[model samples]
Target: MKVFGFAGWSGSGKTTLIEQVIPEITRRGLKVSVIKHAHHGFDIDKPGKDSWRHREAGASEILLISDERWVLMHELRGEPEPDLDAQLARLSPCDLVLVEGFKAVQIPKLEVHRPAVGKPLQYQDNPAIVAIATDVPLDAPLPRLDINDPAAVAAFILQHQGLI
Candidate 1:
């Protein structure tokens, strides 16, 4: 699968942009998947739930299935967190994978920037950033895109990936 990324500081609207771009790409009939990196502890399974209890009871991994969908939760336990390549390998086949965070990983990425956030641009040193999406205009060496324009962002991604 062709992997692309969205990287930016907190409050830069990475999630919001990806949320919009997903449907735009899906509308074009390309299967897409996403991996979001969380900096803090998070949980999809709630306490006292069967799946949660299974993990609490020392299950290394839990596969929960319903009529609609299934989820596999793997516990790292003492193991180190998996790197980008390993995580990507676990995903089912798709035409594209939109990665959020993992800024240090070497992959084609669009830096979502918001000047209001008062953060410095990352692409200055990060060669992996092939394009940028921002709410306000800024001179950049890479292609600049309107942060609010999901269609344009999707188009940039497609073109960058050579899918257009």
Candidate 2:
């Protein structure tokens, strides 16, 4: 599957942009998947849930299933966190994968930027960033996209990935 990424500092609206862009891309008749990198410890299961209890009991993996959906939760058990390639391999087949975070990974990425966030632009340091999506005007060498326009961003991604 084709892969693209979004890289930006926290509060720069990466998640918000991705949330809006997903439907825009999907409406065009292509399958899309997303892989997001969380910087902190996170839990999707409740404390009293069976899956939580299984994980607390040292189960290496737990596959929770239902008619609507299934999720596999794996405990690292002190093992090193798997790399991006390893994570990507776990995904089922798809037409595209939009990655969030993994700024260091060498895939083409769009840098989500908000000037109000007071963070320096990442494009200067990140070679993988091929475009910038922003809320305000800024001078940069890369292609600039309006962060408010999810359709345009989705179109750019499709064109860049040769999915169109």
Best TM-score goes to which candidate?
2
Candidate 2 collision pairs = none
What is each predicted model's overall lDDT from 0 to 1? 0.94, 0.95
For model 2, residues 55-79, the per-residue Cα lDDT tens digits are: 9988999999999999999988889
Kindly give the number of clashing pairs for every candidate: 0, 0
Off by over 4 Å in 1: none
TM-score of candidate 1 versus the correct structure, residues matched by position: 0.98
The TM-score values for the models, in the order shown, are 0.98, 0.99
Total clashing pairs in model 2: 0
Task: Give me the displacement of residue 47 in model 2, in angstroms.
Answer: 0.6
Q: What is the lDDT of residue 95 in candidate 1?
A: 97
